[model samples]
Target: MTPARFAGVLSAAVTLGVAAACSDGGSPVDPGGCAADLTTGIAAYDLDGLDVHAVLPTSTSSCIVANADSHFVAVDPSAQPSGRLFVFLPGSAARARNYRKIAFAAARAGYPAIVLTYVNDLPVGVRCAFGTGDCYEEVRREIITGVDASSRLTVGPDDAIEGRLVHLLTAMESLDPGSGWSTFHDGASPRWDRISVAGHSQGGGHSLFLSRETTVFRATAYSSAGDLEPLSATPVPWLDGSWATPAERIGGFISEDDEVVSPSGAIAAWTRIGLDDFGGPVSVDDTAAPWAGARMLTTRAPPRNAGAVFTPHHGVTVVDGLTPLELDGAPTFGPVWAALSFPGS
Candidate 1:
């Protein structure tokens, strides 16, 4: 699809909003004091050197769907960017707005970041009856199906999601020269060579697919298991051991007590990719030769959210306002942040 058409579909599907809480004149460090006041028990990180900007759809597109509001650009205004792009994909039934804190933290740590939203197929107001019933399973199937559809539409030549994303990146690059999104590339195309992708839940599964299609320096999936082959073909590297890139660059984060995607799936993915189980919070197997970059992390403890007490451990990675219990000196979100900021860490 043409960029214009893709933008129209996205704009028609979702509304956009500036993240006022992160912007406005305030201390660049923790702009709205969001990081400092996180009740999720994850340690607060500083965003002192960065500026968060709301993106608007480019003027040419009739639909105002895929702009900075629905997406965000986090950059440091003080210095030249390293030309690296860190893209974060939100989970099923979740929007990019929910991950602003993580994006901001990435930018603070010096990685230009973008938070993306895809189709959410989960029915509204339906809660996963974790362990009590099969409601969660039904919802999960729908979510996986939705993810497959969205991926097929976006990643390939049809370009529903991927096209709109490139269009927005191009626009943002032009809107702010020498800073923000612009620092990553000229208006023509992104510095694809320096890109890394990360996602949570359904988005995590999508990230795995995207890494297979596009060569990224690093890819990380959180609270997600690989989809069934019939639903979405497993990435070639994961199955045939013929990685498109080094296996060391791919990682997975699984919450030990996750009630959403099976923890076994995450473990399986890690083991399939040649990582060994160290029986610890984090595991690494740099000696795996071709797959030297593979790593896996299990959440030190179960996750909790103030809003939903019963639904524990499902979305500990990207649930907005949810803090993770620190394990091995890092919170649930820590592994993801590290993957984006310091690839191979």
Candidate 2:
């Protein structure tokens, strides 16, 4: 979905920060039952996922302290009557905004997406001067710190943090019209038959860890690099310390030329993603030289008439910038959407 198309639906009062699917030639499936004005141009209700909610971590640990303002947004957007869940943990505030486009686009396509807005809750004076290269390191440190209790930075993990992350998908399964108004829902009750977690930059690292650590998540989609040399100080393994099984459902989107996450680590990870039947090679390789030993899902440049589609731009703009509508036609989501369309891939 493009931003313009998304803005068109602003007539309805769905909540912010988090935001899919359907068959052909049918009336759009909006759980909210929006007015015709709001649903117009929706183009067959290609999507229908919920905004769910957000979570704020309260830990005082160095990682959490450095990232006290960060939050997580959880979503569920599988094809079943009872859908699957996906969590988006963007490393930066800008990255979070970028996912909003993806979330809305997915929602338009009928998949529920959650755009985490934890940055909005950050302390006013906080600032990181590092460029993209160091940014990843800084973000990684913060994430590790956030999860580690022994770190010098110390704070309490708000009890709600875990629940909020889990509830987005849980709520999707037991969705009732009245549920939308509730601020609290018990995620533990939901049957998470299939869960895929994804993120960008630092978020991607977290997604990798979450997918590996959580038995409930069936697959994961991480963007950028192969893998970082394991953190020097931390005992927690990168990806999952316990050596979680190769993700039966692991895939990532790598820009042939992404500077933020060097394609190398991402390619290396594909070696693992390919071990299982559905695990291998769902990667959308943008470079001419595909990752060795990995199946590549290559994309041709957008048709001349269609203007340029798909570029190195980060987040949802990777999709939204291509379309005519403010949000209806984002192409950034094409790859992720395509992956989701396939079952057990």
Model 1 over residues 222-243: C-alpha lDDT tens digits? 7765442322323213333444
TM-score to true structure, per model:
0.62, 0.51
Off by over 4 Å in 2: 1-80, 108-110, 119-147, 150-155, 159-194, 230-246, 273-328, 332-335, 340-345
Question: Which residues of candidate 1, in runs, are more than 4 Å off?
Answer: 1-49, 56-60, 63-69, 122-159, 180-190, 229-241, 276-294, 306-310, 325-332, 339-341
Best by TM-score: 1
Candidate 1 backbone overlaps, count: 5
**Tens digit per residue, CA lDDT, model 2, 89-140:** 5544433444555555444443345544333232111222222234333344
lDDT measured at residue 302 in model 2 versus the true structure, 0 to 100:
34
Tell me model 2's lDDT, rounded to 2 decimals: 0.37
Root-mean-square deviation (CA) per prediction: 12.8, 12.3
